[model samples]
Each structure stands twice: as C-alpha cells, then as structure tokens.
Target chain A: MKKEKLNIKAALTLATTALLGCHNLAQAEPTEKDSWEFDAAFLFYSEVDRVSAGEAIFNAKKTFEDEDVLNLKLTIDALTGASANGAVAQPTVQTFTRPSGNGQYQVEPGETPLDDTFHDTRVQLNGQWTQPVSSNLTASSGVHISKEYDYLSLGLNGNLAVDFDRKNSTFLLGFSYFQDTFTPEGGIPNPLISMLIGDRNAPTWDDDFAKTRLGSEDDKTTADILLGFTQVINRRMLMQFNYSYSTVDGYLNDPFKIVSIVDINGVTQDNIYESRPDSRVKQSLYAQSMYHFDNVVLDVSYRYMWDDWEIESHTIDSRFRIPMGDSLGKESYLQPHFRFYQQSAADFYRPFLLEENALPTFVSADYRIGEMAAFTVGLKYGMLVNDGNELAFRLEYYHQTPTDAGFEEPGVLNDVELYPTIDAVIVQVTYSF
Target chain B: MKTKFKLTLLVPLIVSATGCASLGVEPWERDLLAKDEMSLNASPVDSALDDHIYFSKEASSGGKSFGGGGCGCN
Candidate 1:
C-alpha cells in the first residue's frame, strides 16, 4: 500500500510540471532573425544670395534576436558661397574686413554686402545602443563627435522609457551633454573693436591688430533634459507630448560674425566683433499626433519654444501619406508635407550700431536671431520591394520673409532692402533594408 | 516665459484628457498602428537632416530632441 501511494504522488508531481512547462511555452515570444537597415541621403540647400550647403548622410541599424538595437550614422557637410555681412548697402563701394579680421574685401554699389570667405566642410559620426530591460521598459545611450575646420563637438545622450496601462501609455526621460571647442583661422577678436579699412589711427595690416588676438580658443558646454509621454488614443491613433529644457554656458558668440558702425552720412566707420550673452537657457514644448486609416495616414506636430534672450518661436509641421498601390497588389505610397515657422527677434539683435551713440555691451547682427518666418512645402514617393527593402525620394521648396526691427538707415541705405526674402530648394532620397 | 510655459502645459493636458475618453485599445487592434508609416518619426534620417538644416538657419532649435552638439554655422 505504501509503494502504491508513493507512485501516485510522483505521477501527480510530473503532471503539474508538464502543465507549468506548457504555460511557459505559451508565453515565449517568437524568435526572429537579426535584421539590418540602411539609409542614405543627399541634400542641397541654397539661399538667394547667401550661404548654400550640400550635405550627404548614411545610417545603418542592426537589430538583434533579443530586440536590442544598434545604430550608426555618418554625415558630411560641404558649405560654400557668400554670407551676409551686417553692413548695409551704400551708393558707393564699401570696403570691409575679412572674416579672419586680417584682410579686407570690397562690395560694389547697389549690391548687398557679403563676405566671400564662407567655406568649410564638416564631418560627424554618431552611434547608439538600445537594450530592453524588461517587457515594458527600455534604455538607450548614444555618443557623437563632429569636426569642422575650426570647431569640434563631443556629446553623449541617454534615455529611459517605461510602459504602463497595458502598453497603452509610455513615459520617457532623457538627458544629453556636450562639450564644444572653437578655434577660428585667426585668433579670437576682442569684442567691440574698430575694424576700419584704412584708418590712420589703427595699426597697419601687417602689424596684426592688437585687439584681434584676445584668445586662441574658446569652449562651451550644454546640458539638456526631456520629459515625454505617449499614449495610444485608439486602434489607429497615437499622440506624444514632450517638454525639454536646455542650458548653454560660455562662449556663445560666433567668432566670425561682426556688426558694422555707420555714421550719420551712411559712411562705414568700423566693423566690430559680434558679442552675445555668455549663457543662455531655452525651453520648448512639443506635441505630435499620428492617425492611420485603411489607405492613408496623417502626422501633425507643433512646437512652442522660448529662450532667455527673449526669443520665442512657433512651429507647425504636418504630413499626409496615401497608399496608391497597396490595394492593387503593389507597395508604394505618396506623402505631402507642410511646415511653418516664425520667431521673434532677440533683444540684443542689431543690424548695425550708430557711431553717435555709446556702444552697448552686447550686440549681434546674425539674421537668425531677427524676426522672421519661413514656410516649406514638400512631396515624397516611397516604394517597398521584396525582402522588406524600401526606397523613397522627396523634394521641397522653402521660402523665408523677414520683418523690420526698427532700423534707422541714413541716405540711400533707407531704400535698400534690409531683409531680403530667401528662396531655396531641397531634394532628398533614402533607402533602407 | 512662465506664462507661456503654463499655456503650453495646459494645451497638452486638455488634449490628453480628452484623449482619455477612448484611451483603451486591445492588443489585436494595434495592427494599423504597427505600420512603419504610422510611426511618429517614419524616416529618422530625413528628420535628422531637416533638423540640422533648420538649426543652422533658425535661432531657436530644441523641440523634438535634446539640445547639444554645437555647430559653428549659427
């Protein structure tokens, strides 16, 4: 009787073990093969009579069996052409100091003053790794380094995301830091110094102006944080909202930019090195929504941004994609995009300083900090091939308009267009497998 | 700036709160949202390119991603 009872107990234990094993098998996820995705694109951007840039980029991503991911990206930017110099146009020829603050260049009458020494090539490399910590959590980290002729940036970023509410909602936290160094072709210039073409009171060209060698290098550091939330509104819709804050300290000024000092008669008195506040804090709130239907999809986003320099901006971007051939047994789609952006001028922005008044501690003529608006319209075509490979081509047009910031020009300068409209075209292509 | 921040905060709250009315979705119903085209950033490479272009041309930059990686163009 004792042996029979023991045998029965062992059988019951075996049955329970089998049932548990089956449950584990049912919960196991299907294994997938490691996959690779690649993307390559080239872009050409031009402004009417200002800077133009051509850039090429390549990216590759590898996904592992455990759902971890690795990404690599490389970029090459080639920039050339002339850039606007803060000096206004005059009835006669105007001579200005070169970007190097060493030599001089001449701009003819009825012409927009520009500096032709704007040429440089930049290369950047980035890598990222993402790992799943649990079924509902993920962590990712990335590092990047970029180099130009006179600038270098090294940065690191990390992110963590957690999902809740049965995977219907997710929360993300991210942080990034960067250290950048700048060493211009010539030494850094002292702020607010006279850069006259041929002033008898100034030092000779060969003497290497005393005010032009303040330092050989300057550095800046940036830190940022982002808090984001994403929720699935329904079976075909989802939305994401994020708020980010960033701070930058040290050497915020552009080494090559300058502001002109004009006399009452519109005569160029001097060109001084541009100066800006050494520290800046910026914040932005962004929201995006994506909706899907049987044959089409829509994406929309908006951003509201503000900075310590009293610069505020608004952005709206939208895209619509329609599957043209999905119902006909073909894999192709068309997408149209629209984007609008507007920004307020910085408090310290100045087109040019008046020689009659005392110089302010900080001033800059960079057009980017001025009141402006831009719009872009674009279209794209995408096709999916066998083996999950894809190709896409896109084209876009951009237009920019600048508003007046209460500038008081003298003489013929009053008639000159202080802010000229800029028109540009962009073409892009991408391939991924 | 603080007022702007408060306004920004309120808009998303109202949006998300209204979204809560239809928040719940079964796992099987996610087939449509699973498509690559439905992703918030469908083409990351293109997005990065556009971001760089805008950052170089505009004064204010950070919105979708962290602000780092300084450039000399600005």
Candidate 2:
C-alpha cells in the first residue's frame, strides 16, 4: 500500500510539472537567465494611547527569462501597549472583567478605559512563483503562513494574466483563500454576558472562573476574487481598473472587546462581551492612473467599497514624484503623498446600549465598525546608485476621527464623547539591490 | 444599492470603449514609460508594508494584492 501511495504522488507531481512547465524551456540557459534581487525594510508605527508596533521585513527574489520569477519573504513584528476596552468613562471608579473573564480590573473615575495586557510577537513567511505559459500568457501562485501568540493563518492564492493589443493592454483574474485559527489567552468568552466578579461588595471571585478553558480555538475562513484590466493610454500615461469581491464566515467577533450598558439615567450598569454577525460579503471597485511629465510623475487612485454589514467607504490616494539633480552620478527623487478615507458605520454599531430598549440580537462597540474618517500625509526620498542599488525613506503622519451615527441621543449622557481622536506616525526605511 | 451596482458595471465599459479612439502613442514613444520609475509600483517592498499597516487599522482592504486575512487584533 505504501509503494502504491508513493507511485501516486510521483505521478501527480509529474502531471503538475507538465501542466505548468515553460513552453520554451529549451531556448533559455539557467545561469544566463537567472538574476537575484533582495530588499529589506524596517518599520516603526505608534498610535497615541494605543498599541505600538515595530516590524522588519526581508525579501529575496530570483528572476528568470521572460519575467518568470520566484520570491521568498520573512516578516517579524513586536507589539506592545494598551488598547481601549470599548467601555465608557464616568465620575465613579468602574471595574470590568478581563479578557479571560476570570480576572477583573478597575479604571479610575473620569479616565478612559484601557486594557494593558497587550504584548505579542508575530512571524510570517511567504513564497511565490511566476511562470510564462506562452509569449502572451502568464500564471502565478503563492502561499503564506503567519503565527502569533494566539493566532495562526494559512492561505493560498493564484493569478493568471493574458496580454493583447501588442502588450498595450492586459487582462487579469485572481483568486485567494485563507483559513485562520484563534485561541485567546483566556479562551473565547460568551457574547453579551455580564462580566463576573466576586460578590459585588465582598470582591469575591466567581467559582466558574476555574472552569474557563484556555485551549479552545475558533476558526475563520475567507475567499476572494478579482478581475482587472490594464491599459497604456499614451506614451506617458497608464491606467488600471479592478473589481474585487470577498466573503468571510465564522467567528467574526473580537474576543477582547466589550460594550457598556447604561440605565435610563445613563448610569453605568454592566459590561458584556461584544457580538457581531458571523458572516460578511463585501465588494469594491478600484481605478488607478499614472502620468509622467518632463520633471515629475503623478499617481492617483480611488476605491469605492460596500459590504453586507451595511458599511460603505471611499478611499483616495494621490502622489507626486519630482526628480532632483543628480548626485555623485546617481539619480535622486522626492515624492509626496496624500490619502483620504471615510466610512459609514455598520448596522449593529453602537456606543452604549440602553436598558430601556429591547435587547439587540447583535451589538458591538469596536470603533473600527463605527463611522470614521482618516487622512494621511507623507513624504519619501529615494536614490538609485550607479551599481543599481536603491535606498529609500518615508515618514508619515496619520489622523483618524470618529463621527456621530445620527441615532437618537441618550438623554443623560449626551455630552459624553463616545469616540476619541487617534493620532499616529510611521517611519520606514528600505534598501534594495 | 442597485444603482450603485449598475454604475460599477457601466464605468468599466465606458473606460474600455474610450480606448477605441486610438489615443495611444506609437511604440517608439514608450521609451519614457519603460523606465522603472514610471511604473505604478516602483517600490514593491514599501507598498507591501503600507498595505499591511492600513489593513490592520482600517475596516477595508484589497485593491492591490490578496491572501492575508484578519489578524487576532481585528
């Protein structure tokens, strides 16, 4: 039986090679056709009063004749700091359950609520290969895996492109699928359950705390499809358009987030885990254009997106690159970028629930699903050396704001700000050869 | 919603139809466009890092590459 299995595997491998093999392999010499390239970058990202992260990435690629290529990449990230727990601030000290639902903590009066137990490291690896099936057709495939302290993700993707109109235009189709597993440190908490703490006045611990499992895991899956077109409109201009659709299912809730419950007078009552729909379908249309002039180039793109969760968004990105005088026989350029984004809230998003209203089937306080807008401004400088090496640096400032959802205001807490502004900065350096 | 869907379908057709006007230049004029600096993604590594950052902080993703999904943070 083992011999038969081995034979079957061999046959399958042979068949796959034959199907994807180069049509003109005999015309190319391996040593003459292959060239190596490498890129490395370090990133620092920080947000006010929230998580901060530092990351580094290294990528290596080998290019063969006809633009065929193989790539390998490694990424590492370290994250630390505090994140909001979606609870409201009040005049009295407030206590809430921890993520594990087994421990509790307190926030001082008139202070924003935050959970400081956020620290983790992540590592991700990716591999991809591209090959030309013919002079006008190409195929590419890739796989990636990422691991964190409480999460794991594995995914695969493939793309096909065909050139026509003398290579002035191309059509592309791509598909991707991913599977993810999550095992929160304290296990997944039941949605909308009042945080358990020892008897109210005695500050005793709940007996059920010991029963919470630390090894439970939840799974999520996502599938995506994209159709794209690229055209060279003029010698100095190019344009591209793409339409993409994606669907996600299973365990869509954030295990660490919770919502505050308020009484008729806006007095804080309890805090419970947030809940959300288990599935979502989303679609987007994107268009991009690039134009070059005597001393500069312009790049611009726009995207419109909507989803079944009743959220809609628009994004615009624009950049201008200006060439500077040559330095030491190397070309140098400076680029400035501006980006804008706005999004509507999801149907189930709320700042806080009222005890007088009917219990909601789905509810969440996660600010990401709330109405918001963000703007980014950045500058980058790059240089190309005589030996074909490249070096670049970028600095950016980002600001995000949350807006009202146009819902009825709570009678007593109408003055409270449900969302706080977030300000962040990013710095990056990249080198390639 | 239906009208938005229709517009999404129509915009692409209109853009492609305009191509029939033959507004493109001859092959020799492509010299400038052939330069690496003129490409849409001149810095692939930098673009990848930017994409990752936006995905983690925002509610929407995609338009460039694919396959990486939600992190535990989301």
Best by DockQ: 1
Question: What are the chain B TM-scores of all models?
Answer: 0.66, 0.62
Question: What's the lDDT for candidate 2?
Answer: 0.81
DockQ each: 0.59, 0.44
- Model 1: docking quality category: medium
Chain A TM-scores, all candidates? 0.88, 0.88
lDDT of every model, 2 decimals: 0.82, 0.81
- Candidate 1: tens digits of C-alpha lDDT, residues A249-320: 988887767787888876667788888999999999999999987778999999999999999999999999
**Which residue pairs come into collision in candidate 1?**
none
Native A-B interface contacts kept, per candidate: 0.78, 0.51
Q: Which whole-number lDDT from 0 to 100 does residue A306 have in model 1?
A: 97
Model 2 misplaced regions, further than 4 Å = A1-33, A199-206, A210-215, A327-329, B1-16, B23-26, B67-70
The Cα RMSD in angstroms, rounded to one decimal, for candidate 2 relative to the true structure is: 8.7
Model 2 clash pairs are A198-A204
Q: Where does candidate 1 stray beyond 4 Å? A: A1-33, A199-203, A326-330, A385-387, B1-21
